[model samples]
Target: MDWKSFMEGSKDLSVFALALRAVILYIALIIATRMMGHRQVGILSGHNYLVAAGIVSLAAIRMLNPESSLTSGIVIVFVYAFVNVLLSYLDIKWPKAIDRKPTILMKGGMFLRENMLDCHVTLDNLLGQLRLKGAPNLSEIDSIVLEPYGKISVIKKPEALPLTRKQMNLPPKMVALPTILIYDGKIDEMNLHQMGLDHEWLITRLREKGIMNLKDVFLAMLEANGTVYVSV
Candidate 1:
């Protein structure tokens, strides 16, 4: 099967040289990303995603083509990053030019079909997002906004909203964020200490639930109400 030829490319550069190039390119990408500021990876806008994809494609080409000059690839990567930074600044100054406005797909339980079509969203797609958001029927939603980043934002109708404590004149209760004691059968000691708990206390709670070993538990969460939820 010519395994040796497949493992080592016909290129003149050694494996170590390729490895060194990859390390340098990785560091360059990290520095470029840091200069771009803190933007959530999951919520990158269309322009940001395109710029990132371009940088990746350039890096991949340089990695695959050993004859290609690394300096050229690095320069191109920096140029793309600089362009992204400039566009980001323009987006903040003139949002309308750099960013598309959110489209209102539905208003007052009525589908704005024109807006939906303009946003390239179909009825089935909108309905699927609505179902995911727990709004099965149009009557339950006051509006549906298609965000610029390609996410659906749903607003439930006032009449369909769940009752709050203010509606029933109930006293407000302090709610604390849940702390993860164990995840994937591994204990988070820092989280345990933050909650003023220790391994011995955790074992006692586990024993109360008839669980003797931590390895058997897949997840353990302590909620704001002092409720310990364990899953095996």
Candidate 2:
């Protein structure tokens, strides 16, 4: 129960020791994350995920087993991290060395059965995935490639593409980016100042919109084109 008992590698780890171990593991993981330079959770490849899972498992062992050395666990983490960094560098130099290229799952409205089978992806699952990727109609899709990171890339047929403004011979219009001027009935003075406007102008706009009490207005937005949208 005491610090001395915990430090002596006592068989029963006290709650304090466990908490301290947890903090150490947290910091270790943070350092590992920084070393890996991978910020996005979903962007890691399957192999990277396995490495991450292994590091977590080691951290778990340190937390669960009083006999397990925290120093050893942390060293293992850095070892994994170093190997990962080395492999990543090699991967950049030689792309196919670590991860395979994207697999063509479908082409010209026909499924690549061999690739799908190799990936262990069922036909129904592929169909559902395609739908989720915004290709609901298989007939409209020109191709579908399974990316190395496990995402499906959908390519629609040129004929199935939506009509564009240029195609219609229409003049290009400037798209307005709306800024929040009022949120939850509170004036965003910072945003107002940023937009080169003042409180009096906002009140005048509110008066024009018949919004007497700022508290009654739920949300208000100002667009780059000087358009104001108010929601009460």
Candidate 3:
């Protein structure tokens, strides 16, 4: 076997070269994304999706074709990002012209067949979405609107909705998001600091659960109720 050649990679494109290209492309993508802003990664509009698709295609071309220069890929990625930003601005200014309006699929338990057909949504597809959204029967739903981004928004009928704690005169309780203390044997010191904790507290908690070494922990989370959940 040609083990030396296998380890070194092909003459045209070495493994090291590929790795370097990947890292550079990854960093370039991150910079491009940041320039485009957070909206690019959110529920994508039509133009946003197009820009994302173009970026992916350009990156793939650069990775597959070693003859293609990384500088060219980076330039194209930025170009696409800027174009998306421009389109997003235009969408905000002239929404009716640049963006499609949400279509009402159903209202008052009645399906709008014309709107459904216009949106290219089949009856089965609508039913499946409704089922997924926890509305088994049409009577349970007040309305269903199809967003521009192909997501279905269901509004349950007020009379058909379940009773909430507010309806029963129950007081609300403060809820905090769970913080990860450790993951995959690595301590998240930043998260600990954010939660106003330190290493000493985590060590004491672990030792109480008979876990001496941090490396032995698979996962450790600090719950909202001041509870430490540890998994080995």
Candidate 4:
């Protein structure tokens, strides 16, 4: 039998069963996506979006597979992981092949029609994005970049703006990497390593505060300037 017949022949659920499957699939997708990290959802970069699409696509396939049982769903998660690894390897080996670099529609106040056409962007759509940024008149814009994810980012001319940074009084710059020390009562060892501290350091500090277990700490961070903050 063909794939369709095969699917129908196997896991052929009643209408109620299909409804139950749909509900379960929805919840599973949400949890799976959350575990996958922030890059899995929201506005994704080209590289990330491709992977996200593949993951969701496979998950959908398995969810809809008539042959797919509860076990099949579990297997599909593995399939998603395998596909990610394989694609990642291919992307690293020949970065150019799978990566479609976005074209610049506008730069230095000059419009590049050829590039815009290649990106499948038109003037009206370009102006809409610009107008959203309160630049109804495109002449007030300095540059517009058509990012790979089909986002139109516009930077208005510096002179066009009325406020100066000095007047705003922004800070010098403080960079902090907020690491999750405990997620669902578990310590993130990789993040701790990236922060140049051993598990001993984390435990030592927390112990000083009368917290003996990593599970007691909800979040932690090491600022670029060498300061550790913990949250329970």
Q: Could you say which candidate leads in lDDT?
A: 3
lDDT for residue 194 in candidate 3, whole number 0-100: 93
Ranking by TM-score: 2, 3, 1, 4
Stronger candidate by TM-score (2 vs 4) = 2
Steric clashes per prediction:
0, 0, 0, 0
What's the CA RMSD for each of the models?
5.5, 3.5, 6.1, 8.7
- Highest-scoring model, TM-score: 2
Query: Residue pairs in steric clash, candidate 3?
Result: none
Q: Write down the lDDT of every candidate, Cα atoms only.
A: 0.83, 0.83, 0.86, 0.67
User: Tens digits of per-residue lDDT for model 1 on 1-232?
Assistant: 3334323333677777777777877888888887777652556777888988999898898788766767777787888889888888888899889988788988888889899878889888878988898888887888899988888999988888889998989999768998899998899999999889989999999999999978999999999989899999
- Whole-model lDDT, model 1: 0.83
Please identify model 3 stretches exceeding 4 Å from their true place. Answer: 1-19, 179-220, 225-227
Which residues of candidate 2, in runs, are more than 4 Å off? 1-9, 173-194, 204-232
Once all C-alphas are superposed, what RMSD does model 4 give against the true structure?
8.7
Which tens-of-lDDT digit does each residue in 104-180 have in candidate 4? 77778889889887877778877788777777876777778876556777777888778755679976565565665
Q: What RMSD does model 1 have? A: 5.5
In model 1, the runs with Cα more than 4 Å from the true position are 1-10, 179-222, 228-232
TM-score quality measure for candidate 2: 0.78
Q: In candidate 3, what are the lDDT values of residues 91-174, reduced to their tens digit?
A: 999988998889999998888999988999999998898888888888788899999887899998899988888898998755
